[model samples]
Target chain A: MGIYRSNRWLVRHVDVKVLRGQLVYIIGANGAGKTTTAKALLGLIPTDEGEIRRGPALKVGYVPQRLHINPTLPLTMRRLLRLTERYKNTEIDHAITAVGLQRLGNPFVSTLSGGEFQRLLLAQAMLSRPDLLLLDEPAQGVDAAGADKLHNIIDRIRIELGCGVLCISHDLQLAMDTGDDFLVLIPHEHDEMDST
Target chain B: MTLFDDFLIRSLIAGIGVALIAGPMGCFVVWRRLAYFGETIAHSALLGITVAVVFSFNFMLGVLISSIAVVVVMYYIDRSENLPTETLLGLLAHGGLAIGLVVLSFFPNMRMDLEALLFGDILAVSKTDLVVIWIGGGVVFASLLFLWRQLLTSTVSEDLAKVAGMRPDLTNLCFGLLMAIVIAGAVKIVGILLIVALLIIPAATARKFAISPEIMAALAGLIGVVGVIGGLGSSLYWDTPAGPSMVVTLMILFALSRVLKISYGTTEKSATRNK
Candidate 1:
């Protein structure tokens, strides 16, 4: 399946099957349909003409480009940890401390700094312990220090949760270091489609 | 208290319930910049009222049904359309209002109390309405609580929310349902035209002082209560329509927030000078 451009496809025909329990990183240049590919997989944006299939009772835990947590919203990091209502007591504390946000658990997510928010999102994603985790540009807004911290958390989560993860990021070196597999989108294809 | 006094107390209690739900939900509306989206649901209440009259059903049922349908329609359209949300809202809002008016005209025997539907009839509210509002409002509030994290995730970043294995589409549908139920219940007290003002104005005003969603929701609820009560009380004292009075009170509070913001800015400057 592919994402449409004016004439050519943004994402070319890619046939990659992820085995259960594998960590995958989708690496590509800017304007690549990396985000589109993730949306297709989640069934948010429709596939042009392909039957996308997934296991039964497939639940997705997604963090959008922005979490849109209003400053007025009474969201504490601790309260957010129990979103799925299935996590054990210690698990909540573990997830918070894992992201180095144990201290900020009671503070509202909206009050978090850029790095803090990213870590908070990571912590919440890990809380559910899902079968598959999808992340889009997880380090976009994070600083150098925070990005390094995020990479470590990513590695630990894969080992700790034993769940398959597909992350879309422009950080190619980081993806290579942590990602077990890769998918790249071709940006030139969209530009070429407009000319044609 | 007399029978009238009891109705007044119950109405106030129901208002408290509405404030609680609307406060949190409106926080999303203002932050996500979905003020018109809230208005769309409010406008559609007219159609719901018209349908209720046509079918002889409880008016609230008609409002609930129409509100739900409008929200579902909005969810899909928003997902598919590349157009700005405001553009889509303008189309649906005018269309919904026109259709409601036309539909109301068809029932010649019906004394379409346009004013009541436009503003609302707080005095006419019944005991059953309170029960419906509380039960339905309670469920909506709990569901929102359950989805709080995922909702924030999706609200902040849809891609991230999906990666986390929480579907934004499903979360949005749930949010839409919440908005629908809110519009339905609030239309009885605030009316179709002014309902959105109650939902959004208080939340927007609350945002000026709030630092997080949790505090924002609570403050919005407080603002809503203040707006409703102040408006209701003034209407009783001055012999004005309750609906407009409540909306006016909200507007005054909103204005006061702006003034406070200006004063605070000046205070900061003066403190800097002194320092």
Candidate 2:
């Protein structure tokens, strides 16, 4: 059962499930629990009284809305990639090149522009050859060309690895264009429910 | 000057070692706007120091225990969904400070001087203290180096870090450990209040000039070294407290950097208008 539930805070009585190998998109306004829900699923935040069960020891890859890599952090892509999974130097190079960041793996993360940094995050996510991929606003800072490339990479990875994916986005058109199953978070007013 | 030489050199070495660890760690504190968090953790050291003194334990031992306890507590509070961070830190900081004062008051028979621990006395550091500082500092340095990638990922973006298989909870525990060790190491040199300043101001100074994280860590270390040297020299010559002078040097650097940043900003604006 691909299911999780939480009502710990702003999200009240939330529960959902999807079959394995589904490409699901989660959409909601800012205050809705899209990010919070995602975090809960990832086990970043505890589910209060609920239980989150993983499917068959699946390796989950996530990309968050904002990664505030403090300028003081001593991080290089080569180092960042190593943290994610075991890969040969050539594989690391290939991944970097795949993300359009070839030969820049040694540079510190803080030096990259916004788009470059996001791509690096993407590459790190793919390092594990994960079974489930979760991305939050993968195109926020990406240029049009970069966004296209990111989408293509996501498609390629999914096809090659045969993994499930859950993507959250504020862009409805982009969500529509992706042509995946969608999960919408609509806040239900209790008073309206009482009237019903 | 033999006694002076022995104490000064030893203290300087210890101070630089502490600064090196604290500077980069403090950069994360400043960047995350966790100045209050640092102070809260530091204040908890007093209670730790008091417990150590009352029980006839070594002062460093007491500090280490109390510091670790405080960090563990803070970590728990930080992750608790029920309360906000500012509220949690505020309650713990003031409560710990008050408890420490009370504990020390209860130990009137204890002849140990509390002033040094509260305000720091680098000149009073012993050979044993120096050895502990080295071991502890080395551990912190090596740990940071080992976890450099994970730390950077978590600090910049916890979500991405987790996705990349870096556990933010563990990373935060490591962060707290570094803070606790630093408090224990520097409690004899910079005191509690000024210790946080050492961690923060140097990194802030480095930030003004550096554009990348790797360079920023290096620059922060350099700034810390320079600050400690100047502060130590001035305090020794002028018969002032080492902590205050060190803090002042850092403040002056911060002011200078701000001025330079403003000048550059105006120049850029003018250039853009002319173009």
Candidate 3:
């Protein structure tokens, strides 16, 4: 699949397939179309070339690169989960516990620490019991230790849910260590041809 | 019968109905930072009124048509161009207002009260105005209630909303149309200049104490009602302009809310420390 804007290609000639119970990480240099590939795969953006096909009855859960919650919007973590889909109290508790956030009491999403916020996002993704999970730079804004912890949680989630996982990251070495398979997106030879 | 015959009573009802719709819709506007967009649409109402007067069409229908047309045009421009939204809105807001004024100037024979149109004369609200306000307000209220969840999700994050099978584009289109309806319905009561103030101030005040979106919306509606009453009362007693009076009352409430927030924060901190 390829993505283009204004007669320029952002990503070209990319092929990726994610199977159940496997983790695939897409790693690249900054602006090498890592996020663009993920967005195109999820149908968030149109692909100018090639087609993307999903299995019948496929459900996708996505954790975006950056969640800029509006300050004026009053959304607690609990309410944020409900925004995606409704869940029972017990199910919400289970998901929260699964993500290892024990003392979470529905605090506003803005008030959470970086690590806690990533975990909260993980918990939200878990609520859907998705067939495929896509995470874009999930370790963004996190410390090294926090990133390790987040990756481990993601790995454990993939094992526990038995869902296909696709993650995008700029930290190639770090991603290679945790992922079962890796795809490196090299910048197009004529760099100026790429527009994100 | 005499009580029902009072124009003040009619104005009160009309103002309250408009407030009810404006309150909830305003929350979304504030949340999305669409105050300028709302202003642009409201400003276009002057042109709508001019067109209505020139062609002898229904005023509300003309306003709705013009505002929706503006919204559609804005949407396409936003999609096609890379221009900054603020610059575009600035051009449209002033451009629409200027053209409307110039057009109105050509028809000196028209028996139009420009002052009442620019700064609303709420006391002049007739019984038919009340009916229009209520019916339009009811439709807006019901649509908001139905689309509340999707709208809230879209405001939070459009990508996530799309992942959850909610169409942000469609939701926003509906939202823009609803805003047009409210502005068109409210132009007679608040006028174009002060319409955005009515949409924003009460929601801003409500944000201080609200713990949730629903509570914020409800509180905004209540605050709007208070502003209407206070403004109308002050206008009657002090011989002030009704629309400006209402906006002044809203500002006072916003100021009071700031004080309330500060005091409440201090008290809560102290109480927590004691505990």
Candidate 4:
């Protein structure tokens, strides 16, 4: 797929298929179209050339790179999860527990630490038991220990739920270490997929 | 004239109806940081009024057309050029107001009151206006309730909303449409200049005390209702302009809420420490 703006291609000739029970990483340097490719796959942005086909009854969850919770809007973690669709109390609690976040009692979203906030995003993403989970720089701002924990949770999700995972990574070594298959994105060039 | 001859009663009903719609829609405006956008649309309402007079059609229909037109034009202007939104809004807001006045000046025989149009003559509200306000309020209220989840989700994060299949684009359009409806219905009650204040002040004030989005919205509507009563009462006794008086009441409520938040905040801190 070629996603372009104003005669310049944001991402070109990208082909990725994520099957269930697999974890794939798209790793590249900055401005290398890693996030752009992810956005294209999620259908968030339009592509100029290729069509994206999804399996029947596909449920996708996305963890964005930056979530700016504006101070003007009053929101709790519980309320944030319910903003999209209503899940039962037990189910939300279970999702929160899975993400290893303590039960926060209606605290404003602005108060959470970087790691805690990432986990909150994970909890929200995992709530619907999505068939595919897309992570955009999931460990971008997280500390080392917190990143380890997050990866462990992600591994558990894949092994237990058999959901497909597609992550955008800037750290090539981390992608090599953890990802089942890796795609390297070079800016102004095509995608190169190499399965480890 | 079907129910009550008292213009005061009719004005009260119409003003309350405007407040109900403004309260919820205003929360959205505040949340999305669209206060100025709303003001721009409300300011363009003068052009809508001019159109109504020129075409000699239904006034509410004219207002809706102008408001929606401004929104569509803003969208295209935003996409076609890289100019900042603030500049575009300022250009349109004053541009619409000035052009409407200038055009109206061309026809000296038309019986349009500049003062009454800029600052509403709420006390002169007719029974038909009351009916329009209530019916419009019902439609806006119902649409808001129906789109509540999608609107709230999209406002929080458009990307997340899109992934969840909430269609943030469509929801955002619906939101803009609802704002136009409220602004159109509100023109008679608050006039063009003061309509945006009626929307934002109450919602901002309620934000000080609300713990959740729904509470904030509810309190905003409630505060608007109270502002309407206080303003209308002051206008009756003190002979103030009804629309500006209502805005003053809302600001006072906002100040009071800040004080309450400060005191209440300290108590909560102490209570949390005790826990």
Which numbered prediction scores highest in lDDT against the true structure?
3
Q: Evaluate all candidate structures by whole-model CA lDDT and list the values in order.
A: 0.76, 0.75, 0.85, 0.84
- Top DockQ model: 4
Q: Residue pairs in steric clash, candidate 2?
A: A68-B156, A69-B156
Which model is ahead, 3 or 4, in terms of DockQ?
A: 4
Best by TM-score: 3
TM-score quality measure for candidate 3? 0.95
Q: How close is candidate 4 to the true structure, as a TM-score?
A: 0.93
Candidate numbers sorted by lDDT from highest down: 3, 4, 1, 2
What TM-score, computed on C-alpha atoms, does each candidate reach? 0.74, 0.77, 0.95, 0.93
Q: lDDT tens digits, residues A1-196, model 4?
A: 7787875777777788789988999988899888888888888988888889899999998899899887778777777767778899888778778887756554566667888888889889988899999999989889888888998988887776689999988778888988888888888643334211
Error of 4 at B159 (Å): 1.6
> Where's the lowest-lDDT run of ten residues in candidate 2 chain A?
A1-10
- Model 3: share of true interface contacts reproduced: 0.42
* CA shift of B155, model 2, Å: 1.5
Chain A TM-scores in order? 0.83, 0.82, 0.93, 0.92
Encode model 1's per-residue lDDT on B180-259: one tens digit a residue: 89989898888888887888888888867654556677799899988878877887789788778888998999999988
Interface RMSD of each: 10.4, 10.1, 6.2, 5.2
Estimate, for each residue in A44-105, the C-alpha lDDT of model 3 and write its tens digit: 89999889989898999999888877767667777777776668878877887887786756
Write candidate 4's Cα lDDT for B1-275 as tens digits: 45558888888888899998899899999999998999899898888889899889867778899899888888778878788998999899989988888888888889888777777878888777788788889999999999999999899899999998879878988888889999998887778888888889999998766668888898899899999999999999998999889989999999998878856774221211100
